[model samples]
Target: MTTAVFAGVDVEVNEEGFLVNSDEWTADVAEAIAADSGVGPLTELHWKVITFCREDAAREGTAPGLRRISKLSGVGMKDLYALFPKGPGKLAAMVSGLPKPQSCI
Candidate 1:
């Protein structure tokens, strides 16, 4: 485990920098994570995906992948790719402060 300071709060993280505890997640932390991801900034659309990823992870015991996030998040694949860049599911899951999906690349 590693300690990552975000929003002036220290939170635990995995070797990959994904949050270790969902309880440590905050909107401020999300924004910091998003910023650190080089995704520019967190827009409304970005928030939507972040919220969806967190909620889905809470219910499903794992963060949803790109396919599910695109299908159920009310955000399209093109936009997700554009907003998150690189990998939508992976980045969003990281920013949402959930466990990196076992399937994320």
Candidate 2:
């Protein structure tokens, strides 16, 4: 793990950049992370996914996969791809300050 500063907020993160402590997450941190991950200037749709991921991870103790995220958020897989690019499940988890989903590569 390593320490990172996002929008001036210091927090610990894993090698892949997922937050070590979910409690350390904030909107500023999310924005910074999104920017760093090439998904910046989060739109309302992005917030919807991010919020759902964070809440679902808090309840499930693990990040949700793309299927769950797509079904639950009512955002189709294609949209998720457009919103996150390359890897939606992993990228969403990272931006949400959650660990990478087990279903992700």
Candidate 3:
């Protein structure tokens, strides 16, 4: 684990940089993480996906898969790819401050 400062808060992250505690996540933290990940300054559309991922993770006790994120978040697959290039599922989880999805490689 590594301690990182985001939004002036110190939080732990794994080797892959995923948050160790989802409870410590905030919009400011997300902004910092996003910028670090080269994903943002997050847009309103990004916020929609991030908010959906956080809420869904809280309800399910795990991060949602890309298919779930696309279907439920009202963000289509193409748009998800456009919004979070490289790997949408993994990147979305990272930016949303949730643990990496089990389905992610």
Give the Cα lDDT of each candidate: 0.87, 0.90, 0.91
Question: Could you tell me every candidate's TM-score relative to the true structure?
Answer: 0.93, 0.94, 0.95
lDDT of 1 by residue, 1-105 (tens): 989898899999999879999899999998888887787678999999988888888898988988899889999999999998767767888999998777643
What is candidate 2's TM-score against the reference?
0.94
Candidate 1 Cα errors over 4 Å, as ranges: none
Worst 10 residues of 3 by lDDT: 96-105
**Model 3 superposed RMSD (Cα):** 1.3
Worst 10 residues of 2 by lDDT: 96-105
Clashing pairs in 2: none
List candidate 2 stretches off by more than 4 Å: none
Error of 2 at 18 (Å): 0.8
* Per-residue accuracy of model 2 over 1-105 as CA lDDT, tens digit each: 899999998999999899999899999999999999898689999999999998888888889999999989878889999999858978999999998899743
Best by lDDT: 3
Alpha carbon lDDT at 9, candidate 2: 85
For model 1, name the residue pairs that clash. none
Error of 1 at 73 (Å): 0.8
**Tens-digit lDDT track for model 3 on 13-72?**
999999999988989999999988888689999999999999999899999999999889
Better of 1 and 2 by TM-score: 2
